[model samples]
Target: MNINNAYVIAKKEFGFNIKNHWFLLSSVIFCFLNFIIIYFGEIISGDYSQTDIRSLSLSIIHLQMYLIPLFSFILSYDAILSERESGVLDLILSYRVTLLEVMFGKLLGNCIVFTISFLLGFLPVFLYLYFLGIKFLVLFKFVLVSIWLSFIFNSFALYVSNSSKDRTFVILLSIFIWLFFIFVYDIIFTFFVVLFYGSISNYFLNFLLFFNPAEMFRLISIFYFIPNDITDLFGINVSSFNNFYVCLSMFIWVVFVFFSFLFFYFEKK
Candidate 1:
């Protein structure tokens, strides 16, 4: 519970991750791929207008759905399990530090490192687009939302890490979680909508969208940018909730899974 102990642990975790070769490689690939995608996406959209922020934002959102989950899972899937397997957790727990401190510290450290990596990868493209006359204001909001979205997934990975001691199992579970949200959830949602569009209550449909963090993030990010006509066609009813609700949903996901991590950590202790 001591702030100083947590801060110290956070620094250690951050340094460990920053120095890891896998983190470095993943970050490089992330930066290079996102850079190319953003650059070409704008061109393909055929809207070079300086004020056309929606096109650029949509492009970034599409890539982020895949890239952010991959980065978060890789960085955090072994946060606790690896330490336990190597006996490092035992050594660390022998200290004056509480398990809560360790958990908070590790999560905070990884989040900070991920934020730094995200900025390094995306800021250049952000500035480039800004100079091209696209409003930086909207892009700024996108960056913030994207970082929060990454944190949400990172928390989920940490929960998985806390639950499993097997590294192979943890990794496979992480990928499956990613696949379920990013791809499977939508397919299932669409199937339901197609089958029961008229019968399914709007309230129930909204709940389903909010049920998946990935889908929630996508809806929030593009909610402002998408035209009402398009949403109407799909019967999404985006007007049912505002940005605050979307942000709150993400925060809830982080807190919920984080508590799961703490629960497992304590039960083992």
Candidate 2:
């Protein structure tokens, strides 16, 4: 609980993750993706050009919903376990720091690295769009939420890393979580709706979507930015999703994440 000790751990973590080759490689890839989104739009979302900020922003959100979570997982999946395996985590724990501080430091450090890496790629494209009189606040806004996404999977990765005895298991679990939350979860949710068509209310279905952070993030990116006519970032007129529920459900999801993180650190060494 000592802020100084936590800052020390955070600073150490920051230094280590800063030189990560994966972060640099991913940043370059991110820049390339943004370039495609800006100029050669038809390649991805078929928005066809940069003038359509809404569609382009939607494309950006979808892209982040995929890439950011994977990047986060890869970056933090071994945050504690590798250190534990190598005895570094025990060394850090011997310091006058609480386990909570250590975990917080690791989470903060990785989150900062991911955000900076994202911004390094995002800012140039944002400036170009700004000159074209197109609003890029959508990108800016999601960059803020990107930290939350990073934290979610970073914590998930860290938790899975801690809860087991095998690093291979940790890696496999990370991949499964990334795939399930991003791709399979939504498909299964839709199948459930289809299987129970008239029985399932759209409101409940709408609430169900946000249970997965990726979907919650996708909707959160749009709900405050776009007009009332649009429900989701895709503009797929699925149903009238409530803004109030969006806010409520996101709060619940975050709380769920918080307790999930808390229980792991408390129960583990």
Candidate 3:
């Protein structure tokens, strides 16, 4: 791999991303929306109590879940296919940069841009929580999980973009995958649990929880706010398991999806 060329590509992409007016405008709008929603909700209900704070925080968490995937998909869905369609792929290929370098550089650029956008949206929400007397550790964990989840979504988007030639197909596929994990998966899981009813064992639910990212995020967020007894009823024991395991799983998912992209790029090159 040509490290210098890779760096050059990454720097160019980063510069373009920084100058992109649409992205900057969107980030500002999202931050304003977050502030408006939370502030208005509190004002109208006249309930700035602890319960309201927790509900607002969880709503912000849900917003992150929705926006992160959308931002990552929009950034990555055209990474390679656009170049290929424009006939610039041949020129880039002739520049002595390895496919690995190009792919890695593109992935890095997208991750950085999307991460910044995600953080921008979180800043207002963070300040709101702080003013509400939320614990520093609780706020910190929410930001950490938001960034980590953004990384996971970035990897997933890059993998999908690399695997497909049509940009439209890539976008659609990313949306489908997000919807599957975010909404459909849990609904399906609930259906199975209800169908089995008393016949289903504890182990099956545990197994389901292990692979469900949406559930994992919700469990962690709830554990941060609620009592242990309530969390137990939710079927997640955040304190029982090591936190490192969750971080490791997220890291592994990022690396796994990244390698999958590399494998597809090389196999088809």
Candidate 4:
């Protein structure tokens, strides 16, 4: 893999995506939508005064987890697949560059775009909070988690792009996976837990909860929102345990997904 070739490819992708008006427009629209939703919800619920800055920050973080994944899917789900479908993959492969270079360059390029769009969308919210005299550390933590969430989703999208040959199938599959991660998995997990009731052990239930990314995100958000001891009936520090386990699981998933992509790419090649 030539570093020069990878850089060239990365530059081309970055330029092409940055100059695309539709992408820019859509990002702006979505940012506005997020602000509107948050602002209006605060008004209608009449909870703005009651809400702590940390809680508001968590709300923004939760929204980013939902939005960034969709944005990443859009940016990357078709990256390699579209190139392959358009008959450019063969031409690219004909070059002296290795497949791994091509994949890494493409992934890096898409990640750059993902990061830019996410920060652009999130900046206004951060600014608003700052003007409202919110703590800087809270905002910084939200930004950190937002970036990690983007990486997780972008890696998944890259894996899908590399593995699939059909663009439509890639898009549909990405959407299905997104829905499953964000919503359906929790419902299914809860249903089974309810059905089993007391038959399920606490250890088993704890392990089961770690499987879904959304649940992990929620737990982390809860911890960030209410960091201190809010105890349960069992007198266990639920928030402390939730924070520790959720962060551990998220770290594991990031490593697992990244290696999974590399393995699939090498195997397919």
TM-score computed on alpha carbons, candidate 3: 0.84
Give the C-alpha miss distance for residue 31 in model 4, angstroms: 2.4
Give lDDT for model 3.
Answer: 0.69
Query: What lDDT, from 0 to 1, does candidate 2 have?
Result: 0.75
Reference-based lDDT, residue 150, model 3: 63
Against the true structure, candidate 4 has what lDDT? 0.70
Off by over 4 Å in 2: 42-54, 131-136, 224-229, 232-247
Instruction: For candidate 3, write residues 162-205 as lDDT tens digits.
Output: 66777778878988988987888878877776777678665566
| Candidate 2 C-alpha lDDT tens digits along 1-269 | 57787678778888897766666777898889878766656555554453666666667778888988999988888888888899888788887667778777887788888888888877787686567665567556666777677778887777777767698988899999999999999789767876877776666776677678888887776664455524543324444656576557667867887687677667754
* Per-residue lDDT of 41 in model 3: 72
Q: Residue 184 of candidate 2: its Cα lDDT? A: 97
Provide the clashing-pair count of each candidate structure: 0, 0, 0, 0
Residue 38 deviation, candidate 1, in Å? 3.5
Query: Which pairs in model 1 have colliding backbones?
Result: none
Models 1 onward score TM values of 0.87, 0.85, 0.84, 0.83
Tell me the RMSD of model 3 versus the true structure: 2.9
The 10-residue segment with the lowest total lDDT in model 4: 229-238
For candidate 4, the per-residue lDDT at 169 reads 79
Top model number, TM-score: 1
